[model samples]
Target: MTTLRIGNASGFFGDRFSAFAEMVEAGVDVITGDYLAELTMLILARQKAKDPERGYASTFLSQLTEQLHTIAGSQARVVVNAGGMNPAGLAEAIRTAAHEAGLEIPVAHIDGDDLTDRANTLGLGTPLAANAYLGGFGITEALRAGARIVVTGRVTDAALVTGPAAWFHNWAREDYDQLAAAMAAGHVIECGMQATGGNFSFFTEIPDLRRPGFPIAEIEADGSCVITKPAGTSGAVTAETVVSQLLYEVSGARYAGPDATVRLDTITVTDLGDDRVRLDGVRGEAPPPELKVSITEIGGFRQEITAYLTGLDAEAKADLVQAQFAHALELSGLPRPHNMEWTLARTDRADANVQEEASARLSLVARDRDPKTVGRQFANLLVEFALGTVPGFFVAAPPGEASVYGRFRPGKVSQSEPIHRTHHDDETSLTIPAPTEFRGLEPTSLDAHSPAPANGRTSAPAGSQTPAPAHRSGTTDVTLPLGRLFGGRSGDKGGTANIGLWARTEAAWQWLRSELTHDALRRLLPEFADAALDRVELPNLRAVNFVVHGALGEGVAYGARFDPQAKGVAEWLRSRSITVDADIAGSVNLDDFFTAEHTPASASSGSDAAAGES
Candidate 1:
């Protein structure tokens, strides 16, 4: 078989519950699901602590129960990272479910990613859950041993697709280019509907996003693939959708993974009609010597209250409440919280139609190691001022007890440190060997002033010589939202946030490359003015990406910012108004930029094809 059809069902732990059945019925050769995130690991750790056999994703079993017969009757195989922290345990549950369903399905599982017990010994601090990322070979071993269903604990998300591709194609470790292509394809579909139309920036352009279908990758033996979805599905796949997902949560050009490092700048996206996008020419390099490990631990307890200040004197009301609350806490004999953050949002209007429109919000968040410091005692203290405080002062809701929050930190372990093992259905174990050859990747850094080569390769080697910015002369400019001519995608990577902006046409690309510099970005998003920012250009895709360091103080679970995951950061950037060349803006049809099948003639030239050529 030269091509394999792999469909993704789940993006995160709580994704659509019916996606599994939907994909299985769509007639794909394989089905894969991803159910882990930094926050998810912490949740699973808590579950396992309560009951040892409950660490894995229980939703996977429920979905399997409903689709076991349909899957057993078809040639399609199932693979997922739903095994989470307990692949062995989930595998056992799957076997029991198969027996109860009167189906003789063979189940296999890959393990040895968990490193919580040996964390301290390895010089990694004690964490609630510590798992090293493994590669695809272990999944290959299980499939080759005749297992129809495979489960793994903490493998790279791409491994779900790359393993199946490797098994069907019989690829060797040395085939870096092929592996890299598969890795790129995997990354695109791994987030399920995000590749279809869900969370898309230009959602208004998509005809029907009511119920977006999960994405499917048609992978060929050579590693290139076409991204599409089930026929007649609600969502439509276009070049813009694929491009958005390709840039989601990524940093720099070298996308390092356990299997191989993919050159993000090398991939080319072509829009094929009827909701299909082809991704080709992706290049890959040797796997890094170290595997990334996610270490999650309980940070502390936190409690918060949001009070509404209605009508006049909003700022003065806010100040008075803060003073009263502090004095009251001192009188109550309760120790002050270690950290107290107050934010007063001036959302009130001077002459509004309703009370809600004329009210501002005052939010106070308290965090401390002692639960009592931020628990019922804290709530009682805050409520005491409800009657004695400023007029028209009432909280959004009654204060609740403190809840524990988790902290996520990244660690690294030697590729050989974790024993990659696969347990077969026939009660046998196989140990997969680590890659003997290793390559160290240089830290990625790009100079914004460096011009992209004519062939369109925008990535430069680290510490490369820099040149002064090229000054271009006069053009008619118009002020509008950046979204008028561009689409953006943003996501969180631990504490850092990445925003990727792409233009639909070469003319827009030319304007974007000259404009939107690092200083220009600081002026647009003042929140990151003092934060360290790294900008990378991908001219082949007509795109530029920015990474904002420390944007999220300690990752999602820490709740450092209002939008903890930073999913909307790109949309925020696109909403900013900027002056752009009127000719470039006129060349793009704002309504058709994302919906059209082909690039507009006015925007692209014959030279566009050679932009990224080597």
Candidate 2:
């Protein structure tokens, strides 16, 4: 049996490159790198727009160039999804670096995933808002090319390794089961340092972080792999922490399509001897039909004004300023139709004493169609508001200091764009060109904001993807009625609700938007129903993000971890209705929210809305 001892040099985007050398020294069969994130993608796209030549950093490629010969000589393979938006460009750079390094070793350029161009070509013609998808074929072709190292684009994080193992062992093309097993392996190791201890929840106990060992994957031919830090490393790899990391890998809720998902529960974990855990039994379904499209346009200008408002009776002075600012906004001569929210922040400290500089900071955030018009008006408004007030002055507020915030318009891409892919018919048989003279290229210093570290120990610019590779094979229609959106017994402090819903690409999202924003989904609830949906962020999973602001409406999430109000809101919602199951965390969850109560499994079949009414 060919021992494919896969090693991991880096976990997320920004990590240490020196670990690649350490993995080489440790004698692993292969190495993998993961790099990509939603916010990070925008960040990279912005960088590329600013300077195409500068967007794709040359650090990792240059490092790989220097060690290409050693890695090729050892016959060890390397897999990386370090290719973000510029996969082809990154590969070309790496190839050039390899040629310069005097390493005539094989360099397979693997990448073809850019949904931006095909966003609306595949039967999807909506106002595009956001775009994000994991890679599949990018990883496969890279490894298939037999390059000493394989670099890819925004792989589902798991697809990075799944692509390689499937190609290496020559698993059947439709063998999604084996493919998923490999996907699990990639998911476990993608967060290079996190799998070890960087973001470990139990990090307080982990010792010797300075020389912390990155994550390594021990894969058996059966498609199972155990993720563990290096032996003799300071951190401990327990099932508890690994399980947490596994869940942490899958972020938010939504990805692009089905087949693109990597299910978490499918993994069978068996702790082996020597602090190693053998993970097996990863399963997958088909992929979704549509792709996520992201379009960024110019929003209005925004500036955060932070100043110390110190004076006698600071709280009382701040209150007077707030009242005076409101009065000026009401009559500031400039058009006053613009919406402005002024908040007097209450500082949280051990002592309830008010600070001498207690005052309000105005964060004027506006999103208008025209930046120029808003900027000019904002300049007049800021000065007018300050001039009308008798409490304080800004720490040198200027006219053009207002920064422009980019507004991201998200929608679905055409299904025909082929956003999600695995392996395809190409290899009939190719052979790696024989190793020739290796010429090393000049090494480039890593950018401070580079997502990942030097060689393998780097982090991604956008951190990395949250690992929630569930079954994304088929798209099923789902319609959450107005009632189901409200009510839930959660652990929010003052009755708040943290809700999550899973949907297919059919009319699920559209229907949801209708109910929540357009159709008054919140009106369905009666008691403790006066709540606002604070933030709607799409993290990792191909799911919905609904974080209620005040009532905790039912539970606590990103805003409030465990506020009593949010918990009460969730429980109240649960008591009032039944249909969607709750995935609530914290101490205030109602034990009976998910009892035998369930609504129509198929929402399309019914027209009646089910409410979590108590």
Candidate 3:
């Protein structure tokens, strides 16, 4: 069977710049980059509004410039979604960069994904930018037609991998199984270091995490691939790592794409040793008729403030600060905000060496439609409480003005709408064919079983549970942070967020699935106690994923919460102490898991690391 080696260089817009050169030097048949995230579309739309000729990722040009000789000298082909809202603009930039490097690389671009014209008619608020997700065949066609570089806008990230794989294998559109397997492979590698131990809940197990190597997929003709990183790199590619990325940002069992729908529940992963994990058994079905449409509009204005409280009565200090800020807002004659976020982060240490060690943080965020109301009202209120706050109180930094950005919305458009166009160059163009068979198909709905009906609890399959320890008759129990026994990863899906938690041992898995019910999750994090949550089990991976509906109020970008994207939701849950069998707890190190850096719900200096916010 023929094997194709594919490497991922860039995960998102601001990923490590050195990854491209590193992947090129590693010598792969195909190199792919994923830069267009849901939030990135809004950013690119604003950029395009400012310059007619620029909307794509300019960093791509720099990557080409730095590794031109390595790329041109090798036989590897490049496919990337750095085009953002403008593939033509990005393609042109790549050509210019190539010329500057004394080389003329033929670059082809895929378009027609932009749905701004049709979006105007939807009347779903003002459309800042609208794009339908494209598939991989267009890229395959471009590569088959001898285009060394293929740039695209708003295509599903997996297309970057599947397109080249389909071309290399000469597979037809109906090769759904192979395509689905390729899609799984692409999903695993699309996020670069994510599949190679970055953002992993069990990150402590991976060595040298400070500088983990990017991922590469060694895909075989049988649709099975071994995920591994470059030699001598920092990270491990174990089954746990692959499973973490597999469940990230995903909802339900079926993961929808333009070309084929992947049955994530049917997928399997196995450790192949030597820093490689094999992925296979991915089933496929016809895709949904509609392409996911992302539209961003003028959401509103948002402002936030961080205050530090030190010494003995940390909680009391936070309480006083929160009350004073609210009173200040009312006294300043500002209208009540549409949504207000007041989060208290406790970071108090028992034996403190510094003032920060014995302090907590109170974060205040306000959002409103009126930009002036949010911006000026917040600025004036913060100054009022500067003198009235508790003793030893301090602002993290000088307050900044509110920011006005686009709000994200997810919708769908008919696949047959002829909304996409592909450009091989200025002279050649082709229309991307929409799926003919599966039009207007509704996706399979996820199912949940409640174990404790009175508490609105969900039950996992009995077969999914691991058997109790055979040698012991009775179980001893201990209380410890959930991170000691389980690893988790979380991400946002517009207004929804998913957190996938897994156990390192069978004993732990049984304890986790039984004890961590939806109600239990609510008890751990009261902020979303009333919010609807759905849980499902992946027994093979010993993992459970919880979907929180309406977690991100209007949308991720417009959400009022400090952690709008819900990236830190799982970590926060893991930090909570849980009662587990003493046998399972004995295997984990409690001290390392409970560090000052991992202090429960603690505020940071100005920066919101949890939200990835400035």
Q: Count the backbone clashes (under 3 Å) in each candidate.
A: 2, 126, 3
TM-score of every candidate relative to the true structure: 0.92, 0.61, 0.87
Candidate 2 per-residue C-alpha lDDT over 173-276 given as tens digits, one digit per residue, 9 for 90 to 100: 45556666666667667766655655443355555565667677766666777767667766555443454345442322221122344343244454453546
Local error of candidate 1 at residue 84 (angstroms)? 0.8
Model 3 alpha-carbon drift over 4 Å, by segment: 312-327, 334-336, 349-351, 439-446, 449-473, 583-614
Best by TM-score: 1
Per-model lDDT: 0.84, 0.46, 0.77
Flag regions of model 2 displaced more than 4 Å. Answer: 1-3, 50-57, 120-134, 249-261, 271-275, 291-300, 307-319, 326-339, 350-364, 372-400, 407-416, 419-614
The stretch of ten residues in a row with the least summed lDDT in candidate 1 is 461-470
Please identify model 1 stretches exceeding 4 Å from their true place: 443-475, 589-614
Per-residue C-alpha lDDT of model 1 across residues 1-614, encoded as one tens digit per residue: 68999999999999999999999989999899999999998999899989999899999999988999998998889999999988889999999999998999989999989999999998789899899999999988898898999999999989999999999899998888889899999999999999999888889989999999999999998899999999988987888899999889987767788888887777777777698888877778788999999999999999888899999999999999999888888898898899999999888999999999999999888899999899977877768878988999888878788999888888999999998999987889999988887777664433232222344222333222222223347666677788888899998888888999998776777777777776667667767766677787776467888888888977899998888999988888888777766677688754444333544332232123223321
Q: Report the Cα lDDT for residue 30, model 1.
A: 89
lDDT of 1 at 449: 28
Rank the models by TM-score, top first. Answer: 1, 3, 2
Every model: Cα RMSD to truth: 5.8, 15.4, 8.5
